[model samples]
Target: MKSSNLLGYAMALIGASFFSLKAVLVKLAYLPSEGANVVLAQNELEPITLLALRMGFSVPAYILIGFWAWRKLADKPSFLPVVQAFALGILGYYLCALLDFTGLLYITAQLERILLFTYPIFVVIIGTMFFGGKITRWSVLAILLAYAGIGVIFAGGEIATGANVMLGSVLIIFTAFLFAMFQLFAKGLINQMGSWVFTCTAMTGAAVSILLHFTISASMGEGVAASLDLPPRVIFIGAAIAFFSTIIPSFLVNIAIDKIGSQTTAVLAMIGPITTIIAAIILLGEPFGWVDALGTAITISGIALYTFFERRSQPIRAIPLKT
Candidate 1:
């Protein structure tokens, strides 16, 4: 590999690592004072409220990124793309994130990561359903293998011992599906509006949606007061999440895709689950079983195999960058 490709690989690894750490960080924030953290929140934050706070810290960065991304353009993109991006932002980030965080209330961080990582499989299924894309032999086998792995993890992992395991799994699976849809939505826009600009715009839209959601929740009842009653420690954890998981990894992964193309990037993304599992084990004391190990390995193998052969079957072409 060239030095540049090496750099891209490093960036991808770093991005994957940080993204994996998101589950750990969120778990920390979710934990009660007795479980961890030096300080307790004045009011325990609800999932939606916590999400709103996260978006609060994140939106300014998105605004700056949008301006920087479009600064050099002579003729800026039109209003329609902006509107589309905002809508997608609400759909993808706002909805999916809310579902994800709520699901985490019932699931372990490791399981959350595993389920979220299945978005690629959801992507293939969704594309086949909606876009009339054909399901390949490899895809069929990959799906079976992936589900088998999921079954093993579900049956054997300690996380699955929770009373609400089924509900949590279902919620995370739905979140994964939404994320897959998000990717599909971004496909066209990323090609036309540029990844940086579109991502920033979409995220800004998500911020707006979050603010609206919080406003409504606050008006409805007690959640808003609880949200505002968050302590400095909780606020710091939210800020860390915004910066580490949301902002930094987004750019790093996007840049990695730009540098090394999507195929390699897809394979590198497998690192995320492994990183998450380890982080959960060490940080959250989540149980890592033999079944978890074997299942995760099988899952990643299926994903890597699908990425390889799928890319092989597609026409060799460079992805176009907008602007």
Candidate 2:
């Protein structure tokens, strides 16, 4: 690889590392404080409220960056592509994040993470379906290994678990799929519009979508009621998440992707789950049982194999007629 490409890969790795730490933060923030006398339940803030807080607070930070970039470049940002990119971000990253957070209330962070990390498998499946790529034997094997690891981790050391476990696991899987779709759409838009422009627009889309959803849900009695008593810790943690997970990683990954093409970028993304699992054990004090260890190793191994093996084949050329 060229020095520039190497630098881009390094940037992508750094972004992935930051993203990996996100699961740890989200789990910590949403996890309830102990004791029956605690005034607020961890899950008390409605899911929409959490989502709103996430996007609402982060939007301004991104806007400032976008404005700076625009002024520096001496260009009016293109509106249409940016909007489309925003829609993709809202649907892919934000919506999926909402689902992941909700599911976290019911599942172990490690298990939930394993399920969410299946996004790469979903990406491959969706790519094959829509883009007409063949799912080779290697791809099939990789998918099975990855999902089986998820199953082991999600079962929580008992292979025979109940319905709630299954439900949360399914939610994680769905989150992964949604994010895969997000990537497809976002990357398409990014190719046309630069990453900064694309991310700003997409984050705006996400912010507006979250706000509108909160408003409509509240109006319909489905929203998190406006609480006059906002806990300082909850607010601070929420802001931390928005800043670290979405705002910071968004720009970093954008820069990384600009440096490296999509394929290498996606491969580096595997780092998130690897880092998340370790962080879960150390930071969250989550147990790393035999099942968890084996499963994570198996999953990461499969991903590495797939990444190493999935080399692009050169297109066939037509033969020239004999003179």
Candidate 3:
């Protein structure tokens, strides 16, 4: 690979790694509600409330950053793409987050994450369907291998018996599809808009969606009342998550995807689940079993093989290969 392509791969991998770490962080941030001792357990955090708070704080920051980027533009910006970007952001990231977070209330983190990782497959399928692109044989093989690997990891674990778990699993899978749509929309819009402007608009859209949800939920008495009752460190942690998991990694991945391609990015995306499993073990003290380790290795190997063989069969050029 050329040095530039190598750099793009490295950036994409880093972004994916950060994205993986988010699973661990989200699990850590999620605290089981204990009526009396909730404060002491799991760092006194509430996932939904913290999520609302994080988006609330991020709005101004995104606006500021977006403005900074807008000022640097040489031509006048069009409003339509910005609006489209905002919609994608709200529908894709924010709504999916709502489903994922709510689903977390009913499911295990590992299961939630594995289901979310199904997005790469959806992305490939949707891109082919809507964009008139063809899916290669290797992509099919990778999907099978990845799903099998997930099964291997959870082989001995009891299937969640509750209806909530089943429902949550379905929501997580749907959320993955939503996220896939989000990426596809972002990719299309980003071609015409700067990454910063497009992202900021979409983030603003997500922020608005979260705020509206919080307001409606609060009116219905479903809102988190004590979200701000915690010490300031919790707020800091939330911001750190927004910045690291959302902002920085997104910036990195967008540029990298533009430099390379989403398929390349997706192949490297396996790094996310691997990092999440490891981070779960290290930070959350979640057990690391032989099954988990072996499954992760198999999944990564499958992804790599798919990407390698596919890339080898196709010709490389200065332009990116379409996803």
Candidate 4:
């Protein structure tokens, strides 16, 4: 491989690893703090609050980088693209994130990641159903394998984790659906505005939405000051999430796409769920039985097969930027 290709592969691998860590970090933030100076039970930290903190720490960098990206463009993009990007951002990042975070509270991190991994499958289904995109035998087989894997994990999860797991799984499935929609609609805007400009705009919009949500909720209940008075450990975890999971991986994945093309970068990103599974096992002491292993392998295999067929059938498009 050339030096650039090597760098792109490395970036993709590292980016996927970082992105995989978000679930682990979110779970950690949910754990109760042990120190004497505990301001609030860590478990009391709401999903919206954590989401606010994450966007708070990361949005500044998005703005700065976005400004640079805008400056680099020879011709300015239209205002309509910016508005459209913002709407897509709200769909992809804000709403999807709210569902994912709340769902994580109920499900194991491993299960959450596995369920979310099925978004690409949704993309194919949505494309064919609504966009008149052609679906082949390979697509059918891939969907079967993927859902079979989901059924395996979902059945096992219910027995092990209880009824709440079903609710969480449903929420995450909806999140995946919304994300698939976001990816489908975002391509034109990304092409017009460029990835960096579009991403920054979308993320900024999500950040604003999160902040407004936190403000309204906090004022109505605990008051804004009280909500912001998080314990030091919780604050640290939020910062760590912002840096390791959000900011770094966002830039790395985009750069990787530029260097290696989205198809190749995407194949490399298949490592994300495996990374999450291992991290959940080690860090959160989440259960990972034979069933989980088997299901995960099948799910990944299905997605990989889908990617292979999709790559052959269609021209390459940029992968959706993760929020």
Best by lDDT: 4
Tens-place lDDT digits, model 1, residues 1-323: 69989989998888888878877888888876654434455225577777777888989998998899989656678889889998999988899988888888888888888777777777788888886566789888878887888888877766566888789889989988888888777888878788889889999999999888898988788656654676566678889888888888888888998899877876787788889888898989999888888888887777777777778776222121110
TM-score for each model: 0.92, 0.83, 0.80, 0.96
Model 2, span 1-323: residue lDDT tens: 69988888887777777766766776776667554233566677666666777777898987788766656654554777766777786786568777877777667676766666666677678877875556677778888887677666656563224457667677777887787777655655655666686677667777888788777877776434544135566677678778877777777777776777655776787777767778887878876778878788787777665665564531111010000
> Model 2: which ten-residue window has the lowest total lDDT?
314-323
Local accuracy of candidate 3 as per-residue lDDT tens digits, 218-267: 65663455445554555666776787777778777877877888667767
Q: List lDDT for all candidates, in order.
A: 0.79, 0.67, 0.68, 0.86
Q: Top model by TM-score, which number?
A: 4
TM-score, ranked from best to worst: 4, 1, 2, 3
Give the alpha carbon lDDT tens digit for every residue of 104-189 in model 4. 88888888888888888788888888876777899889989998988887677432375587898899889988988898899888
- Model 1 misplacement above 4 A: 34-44, 223-226, 315-323
Choose 1 or 4, whichever is better by TM-score: 4
Clashing residue pairs for model 1: none
Prediction 3 TM-score vs. true = 0.80
What lDDT would candidate 4 get against the real structure?
0.86
TM-score of 4: 0.96
Q: How large is the C-alpha RMSD of every model relative to the true structure? A: 3.6, 7.1, 4.5, 1.7
